[model samples]
Target: MPLARRSLIEAAAARFGWRRAYGTTTEVDQLLNEQTETAYRDAPDHAALATAKNTDALTVQPGVLDARGRVLGEVLYLEGLLAGARNRRLPQELIARLEDVVDHGHELTVLLADTVRATAAAHTAGH
Candidate 1:
């Protein structure tokens, strides 16, 4: 495809994608924040976070916050991308794979958060 065509397609993809993926700006930003926090939390523990997955398709298991201000999972960042591009004619296989990654990330994030909280509680009690 020509540069112009490609740019148009990409632009269209982003515009249409964002519209279809999230209902509003607030949701998009919230999801983005969730994803960011997961990254920050996981950085100190490389192995645990590296195990999380990613995708280019859509938002699968987006990050979630529980009552305790703990992160639940890996926060599939691309899940937001995928959500934004839901209207795009992406392949089914890609979508499925992305969904799987998102779910896996979510599970991992939750486990890691629990571990961190527990560890902190233990440390506090010991002091």
Candidate 2:
């Protein structure tokens, strides 16, 4: 039934300007808004979250192992150079080239690890 009604009493109320529309926030809506704000306000700092995130990334993610593998590759290359330096009378030019190779490999590994970490950070951040 319309609030603006045909009954004499309702007509009298409407005409007398006593009739009114009413509304209130639903409990669920109010609760949701409150809980959401509380959750956000009480949440940990972004750096803390990222540290926790990277800890997980270092353990469970395959990228960590891939990063380790790259490091190992560089270490082995450098180890060979070291062994050659100690054992054989190797050419200076050859040693220099091997040093460059190992240095480049190390740089590449660091870059790859950083990329992997950034990817993990993005995932943890819900990006």
Candidate 3:
């Protein structure tokens, strides 16, 4: 997944004619890398929350909502990035890749939202 993410970043950089200094990383790159790693680390927790039947709803619901919010935030961020790329008149291929990334992010948001909704429904039904 990191390789795929790096390739996408490289393609975007190439499209924008961005040059990086040797042996140095930009602040923006560092932030993005950190966010990607955080998302990867949180994935297992999200899955566990989704499948947690024995856990209390009060405990699981917060995690479900938090995961959903994070994914939704990421989707929004990607949408903004895609809009900026489009405004800059980037190549169609690069634009397409950005769109694909945004779409995938949206899918993740949807899945997390579903988990949140299911948790809510189960909680209500139990009470």
| Top TM-score prediction, candidate number | 3
Q: Count of backbone clashes for each model? A: 12, 0, 0
Q: Summarize candidate 2's per-residue lDDT along 1-127 as a digit string, tens digits.
A: 3323424655678888886332455644654676698899998796776566656443435645576696877678786866787478688776777777777777777777776777678678964
Tell me how far the alpha carbon of residue 58 in candidate 3 is from the true structure, in angstroms, after superposition: 3.6
Indicate the TM-score of model 3. Answer: 0.56
Local accuracy of candidate 3 as per-residue lDDT tens digits, 21-124: 43445656775787799899867665554566546665677766788888788889889989999999989897999899999988888887788788788889
Off by over 4 Å in 1: 1-76
For model 3 the local lDDT of residue 96 reads 99
Where in model 3 is the C-alpha error above 4 Å?
1-54
The model with the greater lDDT, 1 or 2, is 2
TM-score of 2: 0.42
Please give the CA lDDT of all the candidate structures. Answer: 0.57, 0.67, 0.78
TM-score of each: 0.39, 0.42, 0.56
Candidate 1 lDDT over residue span 21-126, tens digit each: 6678776686688679879986776445534642311111232224223432225465775675566858877678777777876776767567556655655686
Q: What is every candidate's alpha-carbon RMSD to the true fold?
A: 13.9, 29.1, 9.1
